[model samples]
Target: MAQLEYADGIWSGIDEAGVARLEIDRPEVLNALDGAASARIIDLCGAWARERGVRVVVISGRGGAFCAGADVAGMATDAAAKGGFDESDSRAIIENGSRLVGAVRALPMPVIAAIDGPAVGIGASLAVAADLLYASARSYFLLTFVRIGLMPDGAATATFAASLGRARANSMALLGEKLCATEAFEVGLINGVIEEPEGLDAVVARAAAKLCASSPEALALTKAALDAATLTQYEAAIDREIAGQTRLLQTPEFQAAIAAFSAGSR
Candidate 1:
């Protein structure tokens, strides 16, 4: 079987059983969500969302870490070159990130985030956006937006609270706490955590199998209805997040923080 692969960033392939696998391919950078990665992921997800025979979708990372966060290095470089901020680019950035995350949340069939390691910042947003999230014991979830002087994009503020309650989500966002897999499971951020490395795939595959057996139409409808109110609220929250992110991208604090991350000083 051919493995999923992509040129710029996101990669995709269907399993023999028709499960679509979408991977963030930049292992060198911890599979960070750069502009390229975000675009590719959104496109692939949109395709899968509309395609037939793709009963399930699985997202994971190429490296051990599922995703550490957005590409701070790339963001910093772009920000600095534009004299600290380019509104046009910032709009694209926010739109791409939020849309991709929203796509995952709205995907008709089951979308599973098979997390094996750190899922921080927007990474955590992606995981929480999924209908089901499975993480390895070694995995940890973090929302490091406030730590870097940026507010949440990717509809994270809404999704996080929906999955893990307001208090825990607030702490994760505001305090930048790292919620271990066990803690995440307990708080309902993740559906479950596996201990063995192979167990991660097994658990995800089993869940996909179960989802695949169900009526796709019924599953899709149920998912939509269950998530309707929250997603409705998120529509507005996402717009606010984009506006805040755009403004923050222009601030000295975000620039310095990105610089530190890029220079390996984080």
Candidate 2:
């Protein structure tokens, strides 16, 4: 079996049954993505897109939580050292994030997200970007960018709205509220909610097995057609997010919010 690991705690490899598992392995920080981690995800997904042996891909976080979000502390430190956040910094982050989301959608095989706990900010985007999303009862999805004085990125604008109607998507993004697994299921944000983490894992495994049995070309084409129908504005939304986030990052209000958030975390 082919396997690859990255220093940032991302692991990718094909299993005995031809299911490719891509794991975010930073449990200490709840798998919060730093630049390196994000880059690794983009690289791995891109590589796996062309790997014929991989029938399906399952993405999950190793810790109790799926992914907390980005590395806010790291970003704050960078901002402090640089005197303020710049457009270039914001653009690079947004672009890399966009690529990660895009890679997931572009994969020829089905992509499943096994979410165990909190999926916030871009983490929520990652979960929703998957072709199938399964979560534990303890898991929740949160669009928390507004709380931090930023807008949602990672093509969340398109993905969320595509899964959830405009009204629900607006409420979630505007409120920055935590949508629990049950609520997520009721709202059609996720495919299913299991009672436990182990159950969620089993659900994903079964789904992957089912997908693996299907015709890959048919699955890929069907996914492409679905995306074309539902996510017509995905690329435009990403461009808009990058532009808006760039402006937000350079604002005094956003700087103050980050400083306060950083202090509160400490």
Which candidate number would show the highest lDDT if scored against the true structure?
2
- The window of 10 residues in a row where model 1 has the poorest summed lDDT is 1-10
Please list the C-alpha lDDT of all candidates, in the order they appear.
0.83, 0.87
Worst 10 residues of 2 by lDDT: 1-10
Clashes of 1: 0
RMSD of each: 1.8, 1.5
TM-score, prediction 2: 0.96
Q: What clash count goes with each model?
A: 0, 0
Q: Give me the displacement of residue 129 in model 2, in angstroms.
A: 0.6
Instruction: Compose the digit string of candidate 1's lDDT tens values, residues 82-126.
Output: 766667776777787888787787688888999998998888888
TM-score of each: 0.94, 0.96
